[model samples]
Target: MIDKRCSDTELVSLYQTGNEAAFEMLLHRHKSRVYTAIYLIVKDRYEAEDLLQDTFIKAINTIKAGRYNEEGKFLPWVCRIAHNLAIDHFRKRKRYPEVTLEDGSQLFDSMRFAEESYEDKQMFRDTRSRMRDLIKELPDEQKQVLIMRHYLQMTFQEIAERTEVSINTALGRMRYALINLRKKMIKNNIAYDENFYPKRFDQVSIPRGQQGPDERD
Candidate 1:
């Protein structure tokens, strides 16, 4: 029997030596963390599951092709791939709903139980619902940019290429989207913890030679 507690480094080394069971063990250990991360960004349980499978398939191909270099943190590398895959998926689809529990009882339980306080759990649910409503109110362009940047974890440059906009344009749109969302939340009397929704939105900067958030200016 494979030791479930084998470190990522050990599993990766074994995989490089052609031990398929090591790869399986590695996948089992990080599957939930990876899937949850993707689901958080994509906000769709079914779509997240699909993307998770697709990510592992790609990883397998990369490994077979000798393209996977284990620099030690295997799970992080896998997660980066999964994150990019989720972003690509969203770019092709062009829209995403806000994160939700929906029929994903396992995911909900994982997130809720992970929270240390019952109040925190309730706040998470409420915040998710409010975010869903806010997303619907955004202009099409703003909404698309926000989804790609936040949910899909795509960098501004990646978003620019996918959306056919300049990097700067992508950044500006994200900034404006946050501003609009903040305004909407205030206007609608929605309460949330800023720590949970910090200015992480503003860190998205687009490249130059592109329009800013006011492109619709």
Candidate 2:
């Protein structure tokens, strides 16, 4: 049996060694957030599903090419690909909603000292498990807003366009998301670690491995 507890990096290694189940496990594990990310942009279940497949296909191609290199950083990398593809589709159809911001400034607060977050850590077991617990409780829209804003660094305008809501509404959803997250953390007594979560949304500056986190990794 495939060890479902394997780290994403470990799963990628196994997949590269001809273990097809490893890729399946990786897909099963991350499908929700990945699909959610795409769904938010496409806003149609069927189209999102198709885009999801296309995203994974691109990811698999990258893996086969032996150029995949995001390593432990899987979800964010693939999520980016999905987001880009969705944007391209909108552009091609000329169906993209207009947004007010084009200055290209970042919308998130950068986490300083993030490098020390897991310096002494041995595993993601505790962190990922806790995150799953918190995430599952969030409403779908709130979850989508949070994912795009933090992980993708999506501007509020872009989020509003993709979600088919006004900018204020997108901002409101993000507000509620943080409120819900805080409530969940307090309810579960999960101490707020500034670095623990934000590090997951980091950009591609960190050194990468030979296995990349594709569209759904």
TM values, all candidates: 0.49, 0.53
Stretches of candidate 2 above 4 Å error? 100-145, 150-217
- Candidate 2 lDDT over 7-62, as tens digits, reads 88888788888999999988877776787666545545677799899989888888
lDDT per prediction?
A: 0.66, 0.67
Candidate 2 is scored at a TM of: 0.53
Q: Model 1, stretches more than 4 Å misplaced?
A: 1-44, 69-125, 194-217
Instruction: Give the per-residue lDDT digits (tens) of candidate 1, residues 20-131.
Output: 9998887876776677577655655677789899988888888778788867666657776886676566556544333322221122122212223454345456767666
> TM-score of predicted model 1?
0.49
Backbone atom clashes (below 3 Å) for every candidate: 6, 1
Q: RMSD per prediction, one decimal?
A: 11.7, 13.6
lDDT of 2 at 174: 89
